[model samples]
Target: MKEDAFCEEGDIVLADASEDVDDIGKAIEIVDIGGQRLVSGLHTILASRIDHRIVVGFGAYLYASSGVRKQIQQRAQGAKVLGISKTQLAEVELAYPTEAREQQKIAHCLSSLDEVIGLESHKLDALKNLKKGLMQQLFPQDVA
Candidate 1:
């Protein structure tokens, strides 16, 4: 009953082989034949598509856009999705400045913020461990 198995690079996966289509949607990189499994970034359709749209299936709608998030949430509400119908998902609506440079700047700023948060988290963990070690040395324990 081991869950969360990892796939190695360059692995070829077969379609409809998974017990759950939702798991296949999230774990596998691509699907073919209108719903067959394929390696991520190696498939023809995905590679050719230029839109920034992300595909989501049933039980796997958690990874979908925030717009449709509410609808999916209403259906399952914390339960993993099993499969999502094509009609259930819709195109995402994003509002951004017309200038390409401004868009790039915004994206860069957000990315930098994420990196800073990650580094701060690591530093905080290290500091907490150091404080625990110091407390252990400062406190005396009675031995019987």
Candidate 2:
């Protein structure tokens, strides 16, 4: 298949056909799937937003924003594997700034914050590793 047919990075994928709907609606922006063709699991969905910023923001907001989750929950249904039809997804109201530039700005700010959070997490992990190493060196035997 053509590379263009593959799911693009930052594309939001919803696991609509999963055992638990709680785990659905995932935002896929990782590098591993870059330019990779997606088979789209049974009930998995791939949506291409008419506006990049709106979808990106909406995707990011899906998990954290109770309001958005409530909207999705309203439309979601299925006994074994909860799923929301495309029509139901469309029925969910989207609240984005009227101007595209505003949407872009908001996305930019949120992305920047996310990067900082990632960096901080890495630093904390590194510090923890260093402390562990020092402890091991100072005490050859277990300190129980």
Candidate 3:
């Protein structure tokens, strides 16, 4: 189904079709949507206006899924390298919590983990910079 849908902020976008299939299908982008950022030149599928009762936190689910990714790769190999159609993308299954409360809990947990990872990553970068500086101090300036 060709989506006549306009992407709004907070919608989950998946590059349903891409020339390079391996790295393309795994990440789900959350549109900070209502921006001047016009996403063109690439085809994507968005899961918008989701029913909280039936599905919750699809963005996180898509991020974690492997089976759907395999299916997308298989589909992409035969289709135009440019991308897959919205209808084909729609057929991809997502596993998400059916209940709203469970979905919130899962989303919270993932958010916390992401925050910790970001902090640790910043620390690692600082340590690397310190090591580089120490190494430079120990060595004389390079002669031509």
Please report the candidate that would top TM-score against the real structure.
3
* True-structure RMSD, every candidate: 10.6, 4.2, 3.9
Instruction: Kindly list the per-residue Cα lDDT of model 1 for residues 7-103, writing each as its tens digit.
Output: 2222222221223433322322322345443333321111121232322111122233353343433332123424433233223232335554664
In what order do the candidates fall by lDDT, top score first? 2, 3, 1
Give the range where candidate 1 is weakest over 10 consecutive residues by summed lDDT: 43-52
lDDT score, candidate 1, position 65: 30
Off by over 4 Å in 1: 1-83, 91-99, 140-142
Candidate 3 collision pairs: 1-87, 9-33, 17-84
What is the Cα-based lDDT of residue 82 in candidate 3? Answer: 45
Candidate 2 TM-score, true structure as reference: 0.68
Provide the global lDDT of candidate 2 against the true structure: 0.64
Q: Candidate 1: deviation at residue 99, Å?
A: 4.3
